[model samples]
Target: MTSTVAAIFVGFKQLGIADETDQRAIYSRVTGKPRLSLMKPPEKDAVLAELRRLGFTTVPRRANGRQQLTGRAAKKVQALWIAGWNLGVFDSRDDAALIAFVKRQTGLDHASWLHQAGDTIAVVEALKAWITREAGVDWSPTGKRDAAYLGRYGYKIAWAQWRILHPGADRIARKGFDTFVVATTGTTGMWTEISDAEWQKVMNALGPQVRAARKAKP
Candidate 1:
């Protein structure tokens, strides 16, 4: 396919307008052919025009180098990263690990903050797809409750630490600990009902206790 047509396809994919079936239908509507490879230049141009009419626009390249991600894209990237962390796909909380993962996915060596809009979108889409395929989790701009908990307190890791520190604790002891946490953090409601800010507060209140538990003898 021509470069213009390829770019049009990428734009449609990014806009979430055309999947494989929809793309074939679009091609048939525009050029009387369902196969892109069969299209001549004129047919390709018609398809491109149709795509533009449907809100597909070419993204301009940065003159100096790759431009930083825009505000919306940056937020999406952050949310996906947090989702990955909660899903255990990303084990490290370091920003460097996120940058490395983005680079591997996008084949762009630049830091995530320096990625062009297209590269940023590609990374975000890939991350979303990977998360969905592996964990069956939908990627949202504001992450889910588990993501909030993990982002705030390293939830799984914290719990693992707690278990190691209190390996002999009984069910009643566990319940007592949970009660203490809830009362100390002023956290109410079920896990799903808690907001992200509330999770942060819960983690903040529990962090010191966990630390003190770690420092105490078994």
Candidate 2:
């Protein structure tokens, strides 16, 4: 697999594009997000134009839309994808509204949002800040703490189940403590869904820590 492709996958946030025909194929098509490096030339121009409109200069970035991505811009784009996908940033089902939401979100240079939506290394740091500064220490699931029980930080678990989802995979999020439910027929377990062993194999590589973590849970 190419790095760019890997980047796209790594960057994909599961948001359905306005024209998306197959909702299930997000994982397969978004490999490492090599496509992350790619901008619709128009999209790139618009982004640059926006930055300039906001008074930032268009000094040549290591990665420009017309050219192969490079340096900070490439990394930043990759980070955006990672954050977007990790956050499960679903906009309203309306395509136009969702697109507009995304533009407004990152455009403001939103610190907290960016921290949540960025790459692994960056997200961790942002998460630390988010927990400490914004949330003021993690709280119990019920918003109260008891002596015997410990609570899980939700944002920490935000991406926990993500690996189980694959390209073109149909995942239905369950209620609290809900592992994503999967089935073929767009729902209804009677038909049942087929899970690719290959995707499972990728998950297995998460190694002993993840394995033990799964084991430690019910």
Candidate 3:
């Protein structure tokens, strides 16, 4: 097979789309070709673009010519680690447990650094979904509770203001605040489920810091 044809196959495999019938369906949709071997240059380009649109990141080759995960895929790996930590599935210091979790989830017996971009993305998404279902909190790419978990009120007012004051804060900061909310409110419930008074307590506790940060920004 030509390099382009090989790339197309690799792209599909990375997408975790292994069924020949399904692969042919996508191939037909992109190139109007019934078979990958029949694809022209333009068709190949189109199919590759479609794969990228579907969240496929081309794994970069190392100096030794081995394929390595991309930076974006690495972040997903980090997020998975944090999610595992937060869920109490493993302690923060347990690298072996994280590798084991990935092994169980993806059936891949290597560390994330050795994973292909597609494998990393697939595993991260699957793990995040599992964490959300188990913990009753939507997980973000940053490995913290998603802003949506705070619901309309908490997100719109409290989080909005927090972001305004701490515009440069990283995901770790956001995670810390999320941790505080869970601890203070004593539940992972959404804004509607939690009392207005409880929300007020969060605001009261953090409001001064927000104001001080705003003042200090200049």
C-alpha local distance difference test of each model: 0.56, 0.32, 0.57
Q: Please write out the lDDT profile of model 3 over residues 1-218, one tens digit for every residue.
A: 65456666777888899998998898889888978678777677677778767866556467776544433355556545554343333344244455566788778633323334566667767666665554333333332555433453333334544454556545445755667766778877454566655765665565556555545645
Q: Please tell me which predicted candidate would have the highest lDDT against the true structure.
A: 3
Q: What's the true lDDT of residue 12 in model 3? A: 81
lDDT of 2 by residue, 1-218 (tens): 53333322223222223333331233224332222235444333333333333343222223333322222333444333333333333212232332244445334332122222343344344434433442133333533443121232322223243332322322243332122222211233321132333223222333233334434546
Give per-candidate clash totals. 0, 23, 0
- For each candidate, what TM-score against the reference? 0.34, 0.20, 0.32
lDDT, candidate 3, equals 0.57
User: Tens digit of lDDT per residue, candidate 1, span 33-107?
Assistant: 998788887787678767766775443335554333332255557656665555444655444566677777777
Off by over 4 Å in 1: 1-75, 109-115, 139-187, 190-193, 199-218
Task: Give the better candidate number (1 or 3) by lDDT.
Answer: 3
Model 1: colliding residue pairs = none
Ranking by lDDT: 3, 1, 2
Minimum summed lDDT over a 10-residue window in model 1 is located at: 152-161
Instruction: Using TM-score, rank the candidates from best to worst.
Output: 1, 3, 2
Clashing pairs in 3: none
TM-score for predicted model 1 compared with the true structure = 0.34
